[model samples]
Target: MKLAVLIHGLLAITPAAAFAGYSLDVRLDRSDGFYKVGDETVCTATLMNDGKPAVGEKLRCTVKRERDILRRDEFLCEGKAVTVRASMDRPGWLFFGFEIIGPDGNPLQGEGIFKHRMKTTIVGEIGAMYDADKITALDSRPADFDAYWASCRCKLDQVPLDPKLTEIDVPRALRGKVKCYSIEVRCQGRTPVTGYLAVPVKARPQSLPACVDYLSMVWQDASRTVPAEMASKGVLALYVSWHGLPTGKTADEYKTIAQTWYEEGGKAGDTDRDTWFGHDMYLRVMRALDFIKSRPEWNRKELVVRGGSLGGIQSIAAAALDPDVTLAIVSVPSGCEYNGYKQGRDAAALYRGKEAVARIEADPRRAVTLAYHDGVNLAPRIKCDIYVCTGFSDELCTPSSVFAFYNALPATTKKFMSTNPRTGHYGTTKNTAGDKRLSDIFRSVTVYD
Candidate 1:
């Protein structure tokens, strides 16, 4: 069966050398870059100078199953492409990594005009997946998952939601059409639920459908214009910052605060479910919903939460935890199948790598903590209509882990999954045709009245 609509795109390439026109280009035999179990695809790694092949250049190539190296070899680019055939026995990814090595038995360096040789290694990757739909979660859901979340909600309920709204100016064209504000809602966490809210200037009470949009993992403040853009389409929209930090800060200020949070407090008491980072994360999600529902202009129906990557995680959690969320749309989501390594594949990016995997394995409590945060475990609880998008070649949110979460959803839930065969974690593809189709899908769900 044709499992996905193939998104053809230019092969991934390494950045060009600062002084030299040297780079590595990697491509797959199948433009779509997908395979079934036991199927093989040819990976071509070519050393290029300017635009043509770098004749007589020596290349070192390695193949990997995610981060686990499978094979290593050397080839000479003698006016031709160096190729390797790779396959996966299970539902997972295969990566081809390439580098140029000098005849002196070291990685090649770029030569500059002033006789300065920069230590720049031309490296690129070609990634693909096999039988992705068959992937399943390796970690089991905690027995008290529901009870744990219930207690969290109880604490949140005790805190009154004292919402503060600062009306912000809109552009000349949008001044009469929409009104924007920076909003802060009190939450159980130390920080408030901060975001931008936009409403149609003439929207009638109880007439506008509401949407709660979650921002992706970033150190910068949330976009101030996104909610206004959405409101222009006649929807009541709120764009929330995942960190719940104060908005209108300088970029550097936001980055410094985010860094401090990451180092000192992000994972504090991680082994304890009550004090875990996710505890506050979910509190923000719940508070965002409460504030949106409180709006007089809200339709009292059709609440949608949508995002991608880190935002995807919040969107999924919001739908599962809040019965009022009517729909969820996500793409290339992280935090799914957090213990995926236990299945012999790489875990979600947050928990990937040898050190992180070993640490989780050493502590049973950590595993339990992650189980509560795992999207796969939460999937079965989502009763809303859901839509998903994933790239077969994604390294961050591996297709296997994504499928694990998708498979765990209740069979009766209205759900759809779209795949981009040659895309990566960022959804980069050369197929303009296919990319337009994907955009259309998102616009339909996110911009509705």
Candidate 2:
């Protein structure tokens, strides 16, 4: 057996990143479309080089099973066509992709997907198969896990939530009928929580539901931090930035500040719970929840939280820590099954990295401290509704690890878990079944009037 690896999911080679002299664009006849198991799945690609067929160019296709390449083939990029034919022996995920050496000698690649359905799910596990309901987390609940978080929550409660809101003049792209605000709230940490708050100018803010888009692993942009459509859906929406910086900065200013913060924060936090790089982000989220609950315009029973990847981790953590959260929508969530590597499987970047491996090896206390942030360790404590979209072949956040988190939920918890075929490290949208479930979850909560 041979091992193949790519530090995928953080980012992959896309056509947009192609060499400037010759750029590539890929399109499928259809994507995230339907298919039946055992049906001949003929995958094809149009390799356009600067809007023309990439004639005489060498193109390669690699099909994957999880992180492993199941097969590889090469052909000339002629007639604007390249094809890879494959079929799921049974209902499961399949991936088809293309790569070519750019004029600069760097590889540029693109991908397309089709989900094979069996009327029900097949191949429920990604790496190291197990019963979805039976998979257990390797980290047992720390004896003080409940007590520690309880103390933190109580400490947070004792802190006075001095909140401030100011109307912001955003670019037209982010401005309109909705009134947007720059919001600030003092949490348990030295830094205050910050984000953009949006409310429908025509609707009574109190009359609508409330939603928080926690944010993704990618550092957020100060401009357009909040989704403009959030207000149209009958909700007062707040988009929180983990950086806790004021919104509305020039692009260069934002980038410089973010780079500085990452350098300062990532290098300094490794000693304890208080110093961990993520402690402030999570604590501030809880404080932000407190602020949301305090608003008279917010429906007390309709607070919904949503995120993907790292944001998904925060959303789950927030729901577990706060019983006031009503619904959580998470996608390809990281921070799950951190110790799955113990079983010859891989873990998400958040949990299983060179730094983490070193910490565990250097001192046992580091691992103990990290368990406090593990999403799987927090899953059983969640009591609200959860809708998660996970890829059957997400190498970044392994499906098996996500199942471990899902399986441990309280038996009474209302939850839905859906998968996309070979949809590695991406989000679910309305076009996919998992995304439809999320839409329905929110739809049920929106008031018609």
Candidate 3:
């Protein structure tokens, strides 16, 4: 390849997304995103310096495994191609990376982060962290799981949903007669639930449907997009924060508040039912639901709940606890099959790590207490139509745990799960299939009532 021709005509110009100065890429052998377990798949890496292969450059290529395996060679990359072979004994995802050696004896900015899926079956989602076919969730459900949650629900019911709303000015373009408010509603404990609530302005109070979009771990999320837009469609919308911080605060203020929660963040919450974060989270969500349906504007029959990551956990828990929820969409959810860590199957097993495990092991009863809050344990109780979306390459929320959660749903419950092989936790691309499914879901929602 001619260097001038490649630089001037072939390489696409970009401000930032590509590698800083050099262009690098890697492609695996399989186009369908699958490899038979133990089958060696060749990963070919290519680096272009000003669009021409640098004949004498040294590079490092690696595959992530139980322990990362690193290989370096100058001759391998000389011929405009460098091949690294990888195979996994178990069905799972593989991460491959490439780097060019810099003059300072450090790796350069160019990198190839292509991934692969090793599998035994030609069917189903590939690159999953655990074998979907062989997945089994350790049953951590406490014998008193039902009785305990029932008691919790009763406690939540006692808290008066003294809902208060402070109206906010909507951008003129979004106003269109829809009203938005910063909402605070009392819940199971004194912390209270906080979020944005948007309802359609009415001549007299009018009944409406509702949509719930729970939030992620990010700090101050502004805008009342859900409820404000849904108002146009005759649906009430609520987006609640998992942490009970006042909505509409400045982003820096929210950041300061969020840092304080870090003191309360971790496995330390596993002492018992009252201490667990899940306990507060779910009860608050249930309370949010109470506030939603209790509105004179509530149609009472239609409720949609959804979110991704930690928010997904809230969505699943809300639908499980509230029979009024007509639909639940959980994407890349956490809080599922935590016990998979014990078996070395949870991909991000080291995330919470040993000290967290020690807390659970400190008392048998504490482990049992966590069982009541596991998302998989509550899945069977969900009565609504549910859709689960997971990424095969998502290490944080392992797809196997998702499969366990999905498979445990009762036979009578209508459900569907979609997985993309290439995407990681936050990189879910715009997928046409996903769009079609979502269209079908809300499309049906309009008619289900």
Model number with the top lDDT: 1
**How do the residues 64-109 of candidate 1 rate in per-residue lDDT, one tens digit apiece?**
7866789988997886778898788887777775667777888755
User: Candidate order by TM-score, highest to lowest?
Assistant: 1, 3, 2
Candidate 3, RMSD to the unseen true structure: 8.3
Candidate 1 Cα outliers beyond 4 Å, as residue runs: 1-6, 9-25, 101-123, 263-265, 426-449
Name the lDDT value of residue 351 in candidate 3: 29
Q: Rate the local accuracy (lDDT) of all candidates.
A: 0.75, 0.62, 0.64
Q: Once superposed on the true structure, which residue ranges of model 2 sit more than 4 Å away at CA?
A: 1-98, 101-136, 170-177, 202-206, 222-228, 263-267, 351-356, 426-449
Tens-digit lDDT string for candidate 2 (1-449) = 11111111222112423433333343222333234554555666655554455687666666654334679777777756566666544323345555564567544433221111211111111121223345566765788998889999998888898889898765575455667788889986646788878776666546767888776765545334454467645577888876677666665776787786765435246458777777777798798788878876786768888777877888888889999888887777887766665654555555465565555557666566667877888988998878776654465676666767877778778877655443446553211433554466556545334
